[model samples]
Target: MAGTTDSGTGEYGGTGGVAPDRAGPAAAPPAGTAANPGPRRSSWRYIGPGIVVAATGVGAGDLVATLIAGSTFGYTLLWAAIIGCVVKISLAEAAGRWHLATGTTLFEGWRSLGHWTTVYFAVYVVVWGFVYGATAMSSSALPLVALFPEGPGLKTWAVITGLVGLVFVWFNRYAVFEKVMTVLIGMKFLIVMYVAIRVAPRLGDAVAGLVPVLPDGSLLYTLGLIGGVGGTITMAAYGYWVNAKGWTDSRWMKVMRLDNRVAYITTGFFVVAMLIIGAELLHSSQIALTSGDRGLIDLGTILEDRFGVVTAKLFLVGFFATSFGALIGVWHGVSLMFADFVDRFIRERFGVDTEDMVEMVASGQRERSFMFRAYLLWLTFPPIGLLFLDEPFGLVVVYGVLGAFFMPFLALTLIWLLNSGRTPAQWRNGLLSNVMLTAAGLLFVVLCAKQVKDLIW
Candidate 1:
């Protein structure tokens, strides 16, 4: 009841009588206050959460998927990659909008839908985190293993990476986290663009790629490219980052939208650059990359052979940045979501009088909340065992199915929440927003169906 509002004015005025000691210090002055006047313009300087989300979203798997598409279909599916970024921009914007307009976390909005959402998300975060932790660590470890063959083995590096991420996230606040993510993103951008340019992409053909075309037998890759470019649950995490950044109300809406667009535009470049590398370097030679993170290691080896040792080493460093950035991003972002989930669940089920979700976020208590640290540890430690053992086949299937459904779930639910009375009318989705979200929901639904079908059969 703390964050509930009947006025629909989209402003959260107070902390609903929660004790002063529990509320902690407000992490930021309320929007429009003298200490925190809303931005006069949507400046690039306001860009933080978007970069974190983009860097986190485009992990090694995304890069590999885009690379494989280019290797298989050349530049024919390039239009789909660009469209994917556009679609994600809409989704991230919508998520951030919901938070600012409603003065609640996305999980709070999800809980408003039904008890069933609670059930679904409870299972999803647990299973998804367990698997993803191992996966993220392994992905981050691949480049390290490749770079220092004489050093630790894969499992060792994975454990080391996990601990490093945990320590980094545990000790740092949002400000430090954002700074580190930004630095890593810079490394990733430079290396990816360098490779894209160094490949001397056929300018005429790449430009031609802007036009939509589906080559014969290219349907699946086209779909994957569209649905897969820099899309993930972290998109849902964008709002939490917005709140963490101290942009806690509708006044910050313009800044959020600008940040969201810059995020995907950067993501589009990453996807396109990887595509260019796959097309120019691997496709011409009929070389195939092994799927998943190993494929990047393969690309690094190829870069060494073709460019020189320094270039290859730089690419490996970039790969590490991409992987580890995602590792910490999720460690921070999803843990925030999980903390909010537990907070809301306790308040609802046990009738605990907690601070408003916006208050929790803005007061910085959310980051230091017990549930937050618990989930952070959940994301880091249990998965280390997974690194040593083979992931059970059944668990893998569950993870894939849950992962597949998440995007559609996010898109369709946003449509429900934003279009309903829960959000301020001015903040609701417009015609173009509806169209894009509908398209994204359908695309992901198709992708989900295929994934489940493959898992079952």
Candidate 2:
């Protein structure tokens, strides 16, 4: 298994069953073995993790954000949406690169940084997961309630969605999860593009919206458009997905970069398509949308009036796919991260060597680990109460505070880890990577400040 050594030589070393703290330099993978299979060419066939990440990251909230930006500012913020995708591409790429280059999980890297990271992550994951579970379930339930208004109440549907996500993630492995997510994302892509075309967006205006411009009172929306497109804590989970996909070393770097770019490009199209719908349909008529996921339901109602019943139902189906995809994606991806966190904690306490653990992560056995299933259940059950009752103000406030800080946390930590001696010299950040990451870090810091301010006042 790959790991660092006490020697300062920046190369993979063999563990030889030594404890993690005293492991030797990593040895190259055995010749002709799966790990050392020389230089596999990057190809479209190696694109599973990116699809999963993209689907997970662009949930209903992101779509609504893009839609609102369109309704509020027409095509004026289109450039920001595209830039947001570019920023996420850098963040995700850095994460994947760190995993491949260092042969250690992102959580392991964070632990090396300090105890503060552990405290922050522990609080963030617990509080954030609790609130996000209900939020995700409710978002998924909205379309189902709209589709079958006579059948079940909102809380009932929310419970059903949460339970369904639990069962799905608990039973399936990453390969099966990736396939299902791809199908759902495909459904979402087609339905969203279909609506965009049906609304007859002005092509010239969309083309012009690519230019950087900020209209009056557009500051927050512009920042939101740039910062919010397809970004979430799930971006930090990209490395775990990359590891889960069995790309555990630097040899897969090219393929990983290709996958990352494809992921964000797909996300960009989703954002742009929604913007077109909002611009041509809602903006043209000066129609307003309700905030949050309900705004999507409102859009479906408007689509029914403007197009037909068939089109409206189709959009709701797409909305469900988008929302549910995110639910399960988090259920799987974040659970993997939590599993790693727990595994590391146990190893440190017991002075266990992590060589086998690294192998387990690479071979996808982490999906079946005890800690993984425990976290999966935690993400599912406890939050159901929030669907039916008002969220506790204190818990909601904590969730907001943590959620606000996470993007900047991810961006800045990545910058620190990648630029430090922890990563192999050859695999460290290049100029372009540094510039993009720095820009992303700064942008998210501003957004984080605004989010904290909103939560406070």
Name the TM-score of candidate 1.
0.93
Off by over 4 Å in 2: 1-32, 35-39, 352-359
Candidates in order have lDDT scores of: 0.84, 0.84
- The root-mean-square deviation over C-alpha atoms between each candidate and the true structure, in angstroms, is 4.5, 4.1
Q: For candidate 1, write residues 62-152 as lDDT tens digits.
A: 9999999889888888899999898898889889988777666787778779898899889999999999999999999999998999999
For residues 1-457, write the lDDT of model 2, one tens digit per residue. Answer: 0112222223444311112452322222421266546245788988889999989999999999999889888998899999999999999998988877776778878988998999999999999989999999999999999999898998899999999999998888888999999999999999999999999989999999999998998887688788888858889899989877777666677788889999999999999999998998888899999999999999999999989999999999999999999999999999999988877876777767344655555456777777788888888889897777899998988899999999999999999998887777766787888999999899999999999999989
Clashing pairs in 1: none
lDDT of 1 at 142: 92
Q: How many backbone clashes does candidate 1 have?
A: 0
